[model samples]
Target: MDLYRSGDHYVLHADLPGVDPGSVEVSVEGGILTVKAQRSERTEHDVQWLASERFAGGYMRQLSLGDGIDSEHIAATYQNGVLTVTLPVVEKAKPRRIEITPGASEERKIIEPADAPEQANKT
Candidate 1:
């Protein structure tokens, strides 16, 4: 499984060849995302084929997700034997704006609190 991010969206791409869309199941539970694909056996008959690179089997892969992902809002798409899962991250997880306040120009002061104990005084 390949993981990536674009803006507020996180993407997961899995390569599942010869697997039907119905057989593929994707879900996120307890902050962990899993992709499972089950393939059915195809009875082969005596036939001549020039070349075949595809294998005949099922595939399953799981990935541990972080807390930034939105577990409820997840979408998946299967195209050309590639399963692409898209998950939107939480609003707080995305980059946020930090309000900058302008202050009056004054001389810089480096002074500790009077009541606070000094570090040098400690053993």
Candidate 2:
């Protein structure tokens, strides 16, 4: 599993080969992203091979995400045996312009609001 930070996004890539894409499941709960993959075993009957070497096992990976992640906008894709998961970054607690005049700065105290109220306002 690989974790990377992009502009306004967090990307997670898990290398899962020999696993069926349909059987793969990805979910994020309690700020933790979990991935489960089920790989079916191959059977060889009445045939003897000189050399046979292949990997077969169930793959499971989990990641504890950092702060600021929009879990609702997360997306996952599986192609070419690689699973690509993307989680949009939640707006960070940064200083935003409050649109105050030069004189107002002396009298006004900028108060940083909590993230919960912002989310409530959106709804």
Give all candidates' CA lDDT scores. 0.84, 0.82
Worst 10 residues of 1 by lDDT: 114-123
Residue-wise C-alpha lDDT for candidate 1, range 1-123, written one tens digit per residue: 788999999898888878988999998888788888976666677978777666767677778878888888999999998999999999889988999976788667676786356755875
lDDT of 2 at 82: 89
Clash list (residue pairs), candidate 2: none
Off by over 4 Å in 2: 93-123
The candidate 2 region of ten consecutive residues with least summed lDDT is 92-101
Best by lDDT: 1
For 44-123, candidate 2 gives per-residue lDDT tens digits of 78988888677677777878776777889899999998899998877773235778558744776555677768878899
Clashing pairs in 1: none
Candidate 2 differs from the real structure by a C-alpha RMSD in angstroms, to one decimal, of 15.6
Each model's total of backbone clashes: 0, 0
Candidate 2 displacement at residue 33 in angstroms: 0.3
Residue 24 Cα positional deviation in candidate 1, in Å, after optimal superposition: 0.3
